[model samples]
Target: MRNKGPKIIILTASYGNGHLQVANSLYQECIRRGYDNVKICNLYTESHPFISEVTEKLYSKSFTYGKQFYKLFYYGTDFIQNKKMLRWYYQYGFKRLTSLIETEEPDILINTFPINAVPEFRRRTGIVIPTFNIITDYCLHSLWLHDDIDKYYVASNELKAKIHSRGVTESKVVVSGIPIRPSFSQSLDKSMLFDKYQISPKKDLILLIAGAHGVLKNIKETCETLLLKTDHQLAVVCGKNHSLRNEMAQLENKYRDRLHCFGYLERIDELYRIASVMVTKPGGITLTEATATGTPLILYMPVPGQEKENARFFSEKGAALTAKNQEELLNSIDSLLKSKQKQLSLQLSIKKLYLPSSQEMIMTDILKESEKISRMKNHSTIKSQKKKLGS
Candidate 1:
């Protein structure tokens, strides 16, 4: 069922990297599946400048101050969403957003982040298009509540069921999993991957990842502790944080043989493929990538609200474990390194939890919906022409 019409647009924001990451993967998958008529747009930047700057600053603040500031914003949004005053704010926010959507005139819209959902609802007050909200996180928020959304692609059945509980129709929800890149779905031999990185397969591998903005508190201490006591190899990804990378260079030099540090890598899929365990903040994108690669997770210092829910959900499901303090982290690492059986169990659970081809599934549905809309448009046009001729 090939789509033979205008491009389908994927809208995302810079609040977190998860939205853009999912949009890019789906865009790539659309191209791979022979649909080049796909466009990925950062709606925040495309729609409004002042708002985007404020959003970027908020992201930077979260990374610098860590969890408390992030939670503050999250809670603030919750507070606003709970009140009626913000309804006008929401409407004003979407007015400019709708202007951008009208200009794009995309056949179908896939919103990777929730903020973009506002425009969809507002635009549908007088217009309609096939719209889908791809919930990037494992949890849903009030922003995702839109009557105009035709469908929802969510991370898990649990999230889908939860959305249903909130009065969303069950039939409209699809647990297609989070949209991850295709590389995460592939298998790599540990020995081969290690050889490529010049790492030793004999040593246990611990891959630590900071979130999109590289916002983990006490990272320096965490790295020092892991290097001092563990008989394991460590790969630390600093994401977009250049300062952290510069700081870690000295440590990398001291532990050059066992430690690997990277800054904003595009090929994180390879590292995930080889790692025995992943130490990361509980981000939907990172967790999905780890799960896709069948790597067990050691959840660390998650931001409150949605992130906390993600960490708790996956940990309680046995796909991962949460480490509250430094001692628990060290103990968790030691336990995993020594007990291959436990690692194997987590791996099995992660595999069971993952939806391997989620990116493809989501794209397929988007294109299908687009074609349906196009057909309806053509039929309506032809019907109007015939009526005019009869008159």
Candidate 2:
């Protein structure tokens, strides 16, 4: 049975945790479904480490220091697909991806991150392998578009329409909510989570995530404001940010009874399950995870480009609240905490945004497309042999 499964190659980049996290979700689903041949390629890092390293650093800083330039770059390239100069970016990991496809001969390729190389390679090489893009965000960007992409798994109908407006056919889009860990979709023992983390079930839990790189700004002030003004416990996740983790240790000691801090949690969904409110920068995967768990989100100070758009999407949809500064954030949190109806309203709104069992849906769709491509190739092969025999 495993031998019959189509081999999968998921292309992702490590600019931020969102892309790789989506890749991991799909990879795990493939394994669960007995597709043991699935592979995740960190195409950027594997192909050009130096460039990837440079870009990741630049991107991490983009939210804080370089956001204006980032906004321009993100919007400026909205139609780069039609321009001849876009060929330069098409070469980012083009050669390496080509080489890998030749060596692996994968049945299909999935892009968890935007890499122009996929479409460019397919169009240039005329390879017929099924390719799909999992857009791990609420809004659309041109970087994710290419006609050669066989299909797109998008977060919302709005995003699907955006793709349609970009001249991609309506059939090419599926409004599959962004893939997150399956645990989010499963039942969690709330009591077990409380006891395991030594959390006080008595007080409301305010979960603040700084993302994988600790990119959320003003976390210390945000946490302090919640602690001083509210009767809530704090659970701060300072992911991969060692300095922030160190800073949090001091805060943890000061508010030892009410505050807990962690780094790079293996079971983040557990935190999501027990959280009363989630305050963090709006990355699509994180927001999607909160949406899945029905956790109320307060997206704090999203910068320009996708983060802002993601926040805007959820806010406009009434799934979350947007806060522009410390004052606005605390005010939003205060309202949610004090008003049970407000909390319930946000929870209900987020439930509307959830596409049930997102990981399963995306995985099933990928396999379906792969099977179609395999059949097409087999049919073409048979026709070619018949023609030779007739000749």
Candidate 3:
């Protein structure tokens, strides 16, 4: 039986990979559940290309070369949730997005980024579509909070409490966890995956991921440290960073049979399945995926704002270890790799935190609320007709 659900338009921005990953996950699950007319919009790219390019360049530079400026900018804007800025963005996005929305005639709008244009669209067009915000962080930023959002899907109970404290009603918040693709939750035969990847089935696999942009500092040092300090096979993913991939490729001759280098692999889940320990930055989606796979994490040099908070949350839960510099990174990896008991404990902690049904739960709630709204609108139409007839 096909589900009769409302048409959905998921709004996402590509500032980081996390937001787009969440949007894609939701989009895929909606299609699986028989949603016929679902579309995803990269709001920045489609509505404002020039601004998007400029901002993307700045974002990349900040993480790669301007760390101090980025930290200052992130912390400086954290508390200053100005509606004026939001209104400015609203005005700028209005003309481009309004026509698109008008043509799509979507029944619901879901935002994965903190783009505040949705409310403005509703205000300008006088359309009463339900809106949802899936916050892509472990901590709540004030920019994501708006009077117009009907529901919020958060990562944890702590985040739920924090949002509620910010005057959002408890009923409006759902602790659905972060949405990750279904592949991370599936059971895979480790031996089979190892064989397929041509990795040694007996040696412990150490996986290193440097996020989508591949801007992690000292990638060469990290790989060298793992190779020298432990008797493990190494796999590194240099995501979309050709220069970093080239740098890593040069090391293949030195490590020979022990090193596997990849550039922008679509099947990261397979790598996650075979690895016993993963060293990565604490981007929300990556952290969530690691937890889902029950891989122990050594968080390396997380960027200031939300990434720092994510690292703190995971470290406090005993699910991961945080390393501030190169020496600490090597020591953390050595500690985890040496003790199977310690690694299993961390994996158990991650297993406790993982929520595999978050996507399904979110979809269920959305459909139920959509049905209720439809009924209310029908009732109003009937009442108005009776009034016209009597008059």
Q: Give the TM-score of candidate 1.
A: 0.89
- Taken over the whole model, the C-alpha lDDT of each candidate is 0.79, 0.89, 0.84
Evaluate model 1: give its lDDT: 0.79
TM-score of model 2 vs. true structure: 0.95
Worst 10-residue lDDT window, candidate 2: 78-87
- Candidate 2 lDDT tens digits, 198-302: 998988999999999998899988788778877799999999999999988888899999999999998899999888899999999888988888999999889
| Tens-digit lDDT string for candidate 3 (20-101) | 9999999998998988789999977898899988888888777667778887877766677677755665575667668777
Candidate 3, residue 271: the lDDT equals 97
Error of 1 at 326 (Å): 1.9
- Which parts of model 1 are misplaced by more than 4 Å? 1-4, 63-66, 75-84, 92-96, 116-125, 373-391
Please identify which of the two predictions, 1 or 3, would achieve the higher TM-score against the true structure.
3
Local lDDT at 211 for model 3: 77
The 10-residue segment with the lowest total lDDT in model 3? 85-94
Q: Estimate each model's TM-score.
A: 0.89, 0.95, 0.93
Task: Tell me the tens digit of each residue's lDDT in model 1 across 1-391.
Answer: 7665556778788877888889998888877777767888786676677878886887767645656877876777755545354565455347556676677666677888775445445455655667888998877776776667778999899999988987889988988999887777666776787888888888888988876677766677888888897668899889988898999999999999989989987778898888888888888898888877888889986668787888888988899989887788878988987899999999999888788789888878777776786688789889999999999
Off by over 4 Å in 2: 1-4, 79-81, 378-391
RMSD of each: 3.2, 1.9, 2.5
Ranked by TM-score from best down, the candidates are 2, 3, 1
